[model samples]
Target: MKTRKIRILIHVAVLGLLIASCSAEDGATGPIGPAGPQGEQGTAGADGADGADGADGADGEQGDQGDTGTANVIYSDWIDSEFDANITDPAAGIDLDAPGLTQEIIDQGTVLVYGRNIVLPSNEIFPLPQIISNDNHGFRVNSPENIRLTISSLNGAAVGSRVIEDYRYILIPGGQPAGGTTIVIGSKASKQEIPDYSKMSYQEIMEFFGIEE
Candidate 1:
């Protein structure tokens, strides 16, 4: 009986050890523990490369050529009249040679004559057919074949022949019609009117034709 009681006591000790090793019915979870401190930040990465440039654009088309301009206009420098003779005869007039006056100019083109008087104050320039000191100061195309221009003074008060020092002439290529006219000198769409030079002053005429003094 002493042996059996010892064996029973050994069995009870083994069962208690097994029960402690096996997990008991899970109990209610305990409160969560406090969080740990954060770790130090890592070093920053390098920046990316820049983008490439774009391709160039195509070229545009060229424009058309323009029309020719007024290069045909002609002019003469001031020519001395050399008229020192006293005019006792009203019909007789002084003649001056104008070699630049071509047949085409007299027929299809226009001729303008300007004269400066020696006796006049400030050496005033006057257009032909101007009246001075009660005298009819005028000119006439004597001979188109010879290109001669005649200057005459008529109906004067016997105040010694109105002194004429020099003369000038502008030869416009295109004929000026009876009435004012317009022509296209540039591109087909543009039209410019021809000014009446006879009515224009000497300075105005010079400026219009781009002539130098």
Candidate 2:
């Protein structure tokens, strides 16, 4: 038969080229990879926002002045005394009619006026004894009814029953005698503020203060 059918087709074409050269080639090269364990830190990247404000400065200057002070005073020396002339008020007389009095509190001392032919108000307060004798050296006028004496004896003259020509006096102001010898007032206080014996004539009031004889 034609050469045994061409030797069985060349033994089935060399067994199909040995099953296509034993299933062909793609697959070889893998040994370099051992450096990788530090990769779990990839989750930290989120924060940044805020900034704006600045401008203002100017004004300063003024200071100076201080100096001036001094004070000193002196008057040291003067004194002498004698007492017993603070008598008034055998009854309520003298009243200045609402004027408490102020010569800086009547010059703080001595104010003796007894009303006789009046004339004192400027040295407004000091030696004011127009007259009030009994020679106890008399001095009375402080805190009475302040002017309201409905005459007791203008024509007959009296001390105890108000009206020696409408009364007047003064002894207050620590009541006399802090020191003496200043008793010589205005022309002996206008010739002894009346009392040549109420303007004399009882024989010139027994010859002016010589009392009797």
Candidate 3:
């Protein structure tokens, strides 16, 4: 009975050991596994917030200035052809008021001093006369169409009417030949009676031509 009991105990212990060994061998290693299933994609993050604005910049320096402008000439030239030319107006290029007007007269041309012995302001304009007459102390026939009279006072160099001591006139001989002729009139003021003609201004010249200055 004792031996049978011992054999039964040994057999049970051996069977327990064999079962533990078989369990260890089965858990030790395994064959390579098949590819795993694909994982799900992660969610995207939110965008970052905007930054603050920067400070204002300083002003730039000024640039250099431009150069000065020049003058624009309007009317310059006078009459077209000077010699042997008939002039109807001063704007035609003949400066009638210029000295030696007889020479300026074109060949057989007419010189019309429209207003003769006419009084006007120094700033007023008179028309071109068929015959222009200058009045000094008295009317002396200076040319065929010119007379010289005198003014007691120039009225401070003003162009206007003036009282004189004596006044006289002489008619120009009709049909005077044209090429070049000069008419000159004189006055005998005795240096105490009336003013002289030497003192004249540009305004006076403009007035003689009936121009507004």
Model 3 accuracy (lDDT, Cα) = 0.32
**lDDT (Cα, tens digit) per residue for candidate 3, span 1-213:** 999999999999999998888885578677899999999989999999987555667445554542211121011112222222222222211222223223223222233222222134332322322122332222222343233322222233332332121122111122224433433333232212211111324344334333332
**Residue 148 of model 2: what lDDT?**
31
Give Cα distance to truth, residue 175, candidate 1, Å.
4.1
Q: Which pairs of residues have clashing backbones in candidate 1?
A: none
Top candidate on lDDT is 1
Q: What TM-score does each of the candidates earn?
A: 0.58, 0.20, 0.24
Least well predicted 10-residue stretch by lDDT in candidate 3: 68-77
TM-score for candidate 2: 0.20
- Regions more than 4 Å wrong, model 1: 1-70, 145-159, 184-187
Q: Model 2, 73-156: lDDT tens per residue?
A: 111111111211232343333224424433433444433333332243321211223333422123333443232322222234
Error of 3 at 147 (Å): 39
User: Model-by-model lDDT, in order?
Assistant: 0.67, 0.34, 0.32
1-213, model 1: which lDDT tens digit per residue?
999999999999999988877655645666899999999999999999976554666444445653433477777788887555565544345666667667777776777778887666788998876766655666766555233444444553343564567888777766475446656377444545676667789898878777887
